[model samples]
Target: MTDRIAMIAVDWGTSNRRAWALDSDGRVLAEMGDGEGLLKVDAGGFARSFADFAAPWLTDDRVVPVLMCGMVGSKMGWAEVPYIAAPADLASLSRNLYAIAFDGPARIAIVPGVSCIHDGVPDVMRGEECQVLAVLTQRQMRDACLLLPGTHSKWVQVKDGRLDSFRTYMTGELYNALTSGGTLAQLMEKGEADPEAFRRGLARAREPGSGALPHLLFGVRTLGLFNALPRAGLSSYLSGLLIGTEMRDALAWSTARAVIAVGSPRLLENYRIAAGEFGLAFEAHDNSALLPPALHMIARDAGL
Candidate 1:
């Protein structure tokens, strides 16, 4: 009785995966996901792993189109789908899909990642493109500056509904490394998220001679030691310092006065606050909400 299901769209990342079964009109009939991301998927185990996770929807005996986006298309993922150069649009994305032949009654296609050169260095994005495209199409916008926050955050610029160019920031990863038994780890791990302390870190990053990141980072420890910053506020200050630095540098990546960020509320809050400091209006879209229409659009345009 469930033959109306049209497509299975997956936003699979390195740390998590989510899939939705949608009808032709893009209505979600069921949703499934788990923390067993690409890292846990053993070599050559993607077929079984996908099958197990999609078992419920696959039971209908109909071969539906399964479009996967994110790190699942990376070299370490199920298959290394070649990245298409930037100024990319959904049409190019749909056309460049790498199809995987599965024994299950399903047609699987991996959405290739988008790549571009920034500051004369190569940069790329896998899963975030889906959200970017979703924001573009769903919002019916012709141009905007978009931000996707993560371990490697992205600053994207869209022109005429195409991804013109983008740059990646390792803010999250740096914060993790600094707090993972590193010099600043002890103090940063002691506190709740402190807004004012975070603001201080942000302000410090903008100081006249604060260009040297090492100097600014060392202040995290010294401030705590000197009782200038509280133990319970150290983590927040560190987060602010890094995010503030990222804002100072990345906000110039696009000329748009306002930035639309795609992430959950908790994640977007920091960026929103960062935007206010930099004097830019911030808009937010739920990361999960972007996948369904994005996949459906690609599949439809590709004539799948």
Candidate 2:
């Protein structure tokens, strides 16, 4: 029932937004999701967009606080929530939350992203931190490396319950770029997915003599031209190559022997395959199960 709901947790991304109505213990009571992400918010402003989205849950006889994460707090969002630098923990996220003023009965707050310097290269993540928190806490872990795969994949390290550092890999974005439109895109038209092709690509990534990826990437088309690889399998090959390459470097990037992979099942499947190729072990976790609990934890800590 609506009365049983305590808060609404929104994970607003670039192209989509998903919100959950949760009970006092962070258990889901109801849910809603749509393509109305940050970029798609109506011109009425974020408050309006939020009001429209939460209309179903805001049927409150009592106030239902809203906790949001992701681009909703970025410079382009309702308000720019300054990032909390690493090594960051759950407490830091709660402490640095940015509030949005509204006349609605419930208060609204957006969790700030985290920034870290990994190997002198500055990296930052918006929505993934909450998932990281959930993973660590759910698994009863104080130290672990987490892999959050998506358009921009993140390899995060947590130590003593804090996000020590993380690195971003443009694996998924690059895949889309290559296949969206280009010479490579043309070759993938009739391609059937081939696991062997993917495995071969993964093997190619780990080869010492494969040289730099830029030099090797062109093979996706050449193999097709020579009939050495099927056109339909080229996409799978490209996927394996990129993910395998990420694994090759990421495995070396962190000292953690195994990683906890978090994200949609569809996205994590390829990563799981790549992990197998690298002889690396990983545990898959669905973000949907993790984010709400994490948001609730943040809300509780923020005294919402």
Candidate 3:
């Protein structure tokens, strides 16, 4: 027979949901997920949706304590769990969880997001904060600048194992909007990742000027129109431009000398390359390795 799951770990996001059946020692017993994200979960459907996805593991005749993190805790998600102010550690995060009595026998707790003021500007991160905590703990990083790339990319600074400050970059979403349905959609052509053209875009993004972004973005179309940038390379070039701009700006605010990129392999690769441009060493850790221990730490402290 399979090992008993001691805790149910859930990572619910805007687009997807993943739940892991974890044993007492935080080992994975089984896993399941779906597209029933916050966006798709209708009003009052969160409990039903969660129970359905977790049905297989719920066969045991007991209520399983669920520790969930991500956009599921956002205002638009199941419940509007308030954000935990920044300069916090795992202990603070675990202590401030938002709990709810499920319609069924199970007990559910949502991890609150973290907010910080960097350079007099307020920034917040929901799911990424948990990931950042996991990465810092797993790596035993004392002082590190961490990058989590996504639709809304995050650059977090950790000092002495506590979250000091961070910044959010709209790189991925901007690229998506520009290519998918935005004004520049007509100019971009899908193609394989081209390192050369990508580097060219990165260089363009680094050009010093007052209105460089708009000017450089327009260059993508003009360059393609004049047959300067190949159609097959336009997508990669645009990706480089966006990521490069993010790196160029984010790297300045970060105090750590090297960076740790935490995300998928493809996204990490882009960040690694971008970090190399600024002569910063890059390290990576996937979600699977970083998340399990992180969740356990938080849940345990929360008495879940």
Q: Which of the numbered candidates is closest to the native, going by highest lDDT? A: 2
Q: Note the residue pairs that clash in candidate 3.
A: none
Q: What's the TM-score of every candidate structure?
A: 0.97, 0.96, 0.95
- Worst 10-residue stretch by lDDT in candidate 1? 183-192
Predicted candidate 2 versus true structure: per-residue lDDT over 1-304, tens digit per residue: 8788899999988899999999998899999899987787654488878887788778746778999999988888888899889998888999998988987867899999999875678899998999999888888899999999988999998999899988899999999999999888887855467889889999999998797888778999898789898788899899999998888888888998788999999998888888877777889998888899999999999999
| Residues 1-304, model 1: lDDT tens digits | 2587888999888989999999989889889889989999999999999999998888645788899999999989999999999999988998998999899978999888999986789999998888899999878999999999989999999999899999899999998898887768876546468899888888888677787787888989998789887788888898999998888888656677899999888989998888888788989888888889888889888878
**Model 3 agreement with the true structure over 1-304: per-residue lDDT tens digits:** 1338788888999999888888888888878788888899898889888878887777546777888999999888989899888898999899999997687756799999999986778899997888889887777877889889988999898888998888998888888788887546787677778999988888777777724577778888888889998877887888888888888888767666788888988788888887887788898878656666778789988889
- Residue 259's lDDT in candidate 3: 83
Instruction: Give candidate 1 misplaced runs (Cα > 4 Å).
Output: none
- The candidates, ranked best first by lDDT, are 2, 1, 3
How accurate locally, in lDDT, is each candidate? 0.88, 0.88, 0.83
